[model samples]
Target: MSRVLKPNANNLETGTTTVGMVARDAVVLATDRRVTAGYYIAHRRGRKIWRIDDHVAATMSGGVADVQKILEALTLQAMDYKIRTGLPVPVKTLANYASVAMFSSRPYIFIAHMILGGVTEQEGPVLYTIDWYGSVTEERRFASTGSGSPTAFGVLEDGYRDGMSLEDAIKLGIRAVRAAMMHDPASGEGVDVITITPKEGFKEIDTSKYL
Candidate 1:
């Protein structure tokens, strides 16, 4: 027999908002800071974004402990790849590993969606939307996940343009998450933002004004 976990209102998948956008020269990722246990606020300053390496990052929307373990494993994989190959691990490879981790859990899935983003010379600015079932889609423009995604998509629609600046991408990412926070009860408190640029690699941006 396998341990099974069913969906509910308070699960990680339905308790947050996370967004990722690919600019011409950068990739931006953002998420809300609230953690909910059903109707109760379990934590106020929850961090959904994890930096896998200097050039890569991911957003989590599931069981915190499970997600953290998956991300930590990815971090080790990245380091090991670089040590072996002498280069940063490609973005798609990281996403694929995440998918495998979720899929391998079988009946007891990881109940999470990860939006992976990074900058690499080989793939440029890359983004991936990965579901709990281990399906992966390479995002050319942008992607959002979690309970607040529907609301966030509304703000992202018609706003993204070709060759937008990194600053513009950051602004748009913040706006999307903020809009979801206003409409989704599970997503609120504050917004966190980060950008991976060709020159800067990975950097966290202050989003106080936008929030």
Candidate 2:
């Protein structure tokens, strides 16, 4: 568990805390809004989560520019696929695309860790964690990334339950991020949470009450 929690050199350099959870009928992606450079705080309102499709979203924890470029490419590809096939991209398919993009880059691979979460008529709710090495793991319950992930994972693993309600899941996500903030200097300045559901698609919730 200590080994899993240790941040790679890249994660330590980039600095962030992002977590994703699979709920009964929804997927929640939450992250702190702070961006850092060494011991310096770069941005207080940085965005780590993005909506890629109607029901798919991604959270990042690495080189901001590199992650943004990859996510932008993904958004374009998803949009193109929907235009041509009249169907949303499969959750796993999107995850693989990200993996391939990183792996294909070889020695100069993209420096990013990502959590992709979404919902669909075929797969219900789903989540995947993609590391800088292009490794993709389909998370059955929850996944956390970045410098503060160790603390976040502790809270997530202890509190998460199968088939939890969406509201309960969101609160848990917030709690995990908050817990990470307490211990991880890189993570703080409030949190942003977004939920993906088959019924409502991608929706950002006002997390002020929870924060």
Candidate 3:
């Protein structure tokens, strides 16, 4: 049997900010909550961070509907892979699946960008950026997406360091997203952050206080 996931109609046109970083022991993912529709602000508490599995999560940008569609597809693929193999899907495999999906949909006008981060038994902490056209790049340190990425990259480049503690990585992720929110008109409202570690898997941090 096959399952099909429907996209959210209302979020077809939206703007956002998303960032992901790989630290020594964990991977950090963050994004702004604001959803923009052209010059208007549509939703303030929109969710851009998606949890794919216990150790994998994704941050999204571009059309929310397309983002949701891609996430749904990835989630289904992960579940099927686990059921068939009795093992969790690796971070790279998931990235490759997403890349194929994006590339197949490119000619149809489906557009979305994603930053996927996770911890695996073999790869430890890893991060990958999947562009709208299905091009995937494994980012050794960090990656950012959406309209505010330029501003977010500034903070990430300045603050990120090798082998930093997970706490410090979370703080840096927050700082990067916060800087983008402050400067990017399309990115604002609040920040959502998640950390993936071998011990605790994927967990979301309460970042309301940071805004």
Candidate 4:
């Protein structure tokens, strides 16, 4: 991660952290948006976090190109599967499929960690972290992943609480990223924050509002 921070200005460097806070019957997904190029800041508003469908969203970190490809493939697959089956893919089923696809990629392995968040058809909101090998597991109230994750997780552990409101959740997410930027060499200055709730699929919120 530190290596990415010290590269040449023309070389693209990126790092991210996804936080999922679970409440009684809902979940709030958030991420710190930071993408750099070597020592230079390239994009402050790069939305590394996104919704894959009406009820499923993900926040990803790692090799940018690999992550993008995996996301595109997964999106297409999900759409096709849904169209054919006439039902949204179950969260567990989608996670399992992603795991298989990512684990099988050869050339450049997808060194990415993504937080898959959404409300299940039968259950309430669910949150899980998926890794490069496609390993996925449920999280508690909150979880963070990526190069800056160690630091971000610290902040989250301190601020996270059950039944947190959307505004509070956003604040905690920003605070966690801010804390990470202070200590993580790979995580830079600018923070891009996004939110995904049951009503709203995915929405990028103003950093100033959270900061």
Candidate 5:
């Protein structure tokens, strides 16, 4: 349920809200399902969250095509790494890889902002934010991106707590995205949520009941 948005000069900043948080034993990612182009709602049910592997997932913001291309490359790279080394790629490693890719493509107008999350045998749950310019930050608690990020950050900074349960984190993630959607014209339609844990790996929650 996603539609492509044609970019324009005035709609260069068009984007949605995406949030990610690390909980006690898992990581949660949530996003609004909207795509916009110069104040026009191009898609009402766009997908912003993606599962990268059994225990890794990502939420994206910025040009849909650019983000999709980066994610596809990351997926292939992850598979190749796993097959060659018989080990899951570290979450930070993936973030760095994405940063390098994005940085390398900056001159070519490639833009993609992403929050990557996953659980590793050694690291437990980890989260990282990679910007379009290749800047990468290891977010210890939570991260939010896109045009609605400011509003989403307000909710996350106020509601987030240390060592919260996965359920609480999911609720907060949803709340953050919902708040952003309410305020940001570029974000709306519905919500999509995903959770990653050692036990369940990566699982998409049924956002239909709530959104």
Candidate 6:
């Protein structure tokens, strides 16, 4: 990571959702957008989730600027990794490498947390959250983080089901973020939702429908 993750810095607060589903042959991931700056709305269409490669996408919640930086850095590194290895790294492996890079660059900084989701060329689909210190681990169904994670998780627990459809995923994502917006001062108002279907690739959903 080129930039440091500073835990104490209070620049921006955010909420994000990263969902991973394993179908018969593909994977899907989705994320939400909502950022709060102090007592005001910062960005309504913050694209917290992104496609860094054809088969990989990520959702982030942390220092907005820092997370953006990490995304750029990761994109470059991912391209390099693909070029050098001629293979697609598993989502877990890529995320673990990112964690190591972040901590090694600045151990004192705790500025970013992220969920990476993708399907390996051989291992099916995967989802994992990388913490401020760069610890990465797998999540079975879905994962969320940031200021509104707790509230959002409440909705996730109630609605998530195995092998849920793309429609269900979107519904649950909106409901979770909507509920979070109600209580989490740092979340809500405007929403940016994105869904990635393995073969079709990433699509930034119409914000009007989600909000």
Model-by-model lDDT, in order? 0.85, 0.87, 0.84, 0.68, 0.85, 0.66
Please provide the root mean square deviation of candidate 1 (C-alpha atoms, Å): 3.5
Clashes of each: 0, 0, 0, 0, 0, 4
- Order the candidate numbers by lDDT, best to worst: 2, 5, 1, 3, 4, 6
Error of 6 at 189 (Å): 3.0
Ten contiguous residues minimizing lDDT sum, candidate 4: 1-10
lDDT of 4 at 68: 75
lDDT of 4 by residue, 50-105 (tens): 66777777777766766777778778877987999987666666677778888787
**24 Cα displacement, candidate 5 (Å):** 0.5
Q: Which runs of model 3 end up more than 4 angstroms from their true locations?
A: 1-14, 208-211
Q: Tens-digit lDDT track for model 5 on 1-211?
A: 1222543435445378899999998999999998876577888888888889998989978877888988998899889999999999888888888988888874665567789999999889999998767789999999998888899999999999999999899889889999998898889998899999999898989866664
- TM-score of candidate 6 on Cα atoms, chains taken together: 0.81
The CA-based lDDT of model 5 is what?
Answer: 0.85
Give the per-residue lDDT of model 6 (tens digit) for 176-204. Answer: 77777777766654555556555665566
- Quick one: best TM-score, which candidate? 2
lDDT of 2 by residue, 1-211 (tens): 0112344544334478999999999999999999886677888998899899988999988877778878998899899889999999888988999999988887776767899999989888999988777899999999999888889999998999999999999999999999999999989999999999888999999998875
What TM-score does each of the candidates earn?
A: 0.93, 0.93, 0.91, 0.81, 0.91, 0.81
Which candidate's lDDT is highest? 2
Residue pairs with clashing backbones, model 6: 5-109, 5-110, 5-111, 6-111
Q: Candidate 6: list runs displaced more than 4 Å.
A: 1-32, 85-87, 207-211
Candidate 2: segments with Cα more than 4 A from true spot: 1-13
Candidate 1 C-alpha error for residue 170, in Å: 1.0
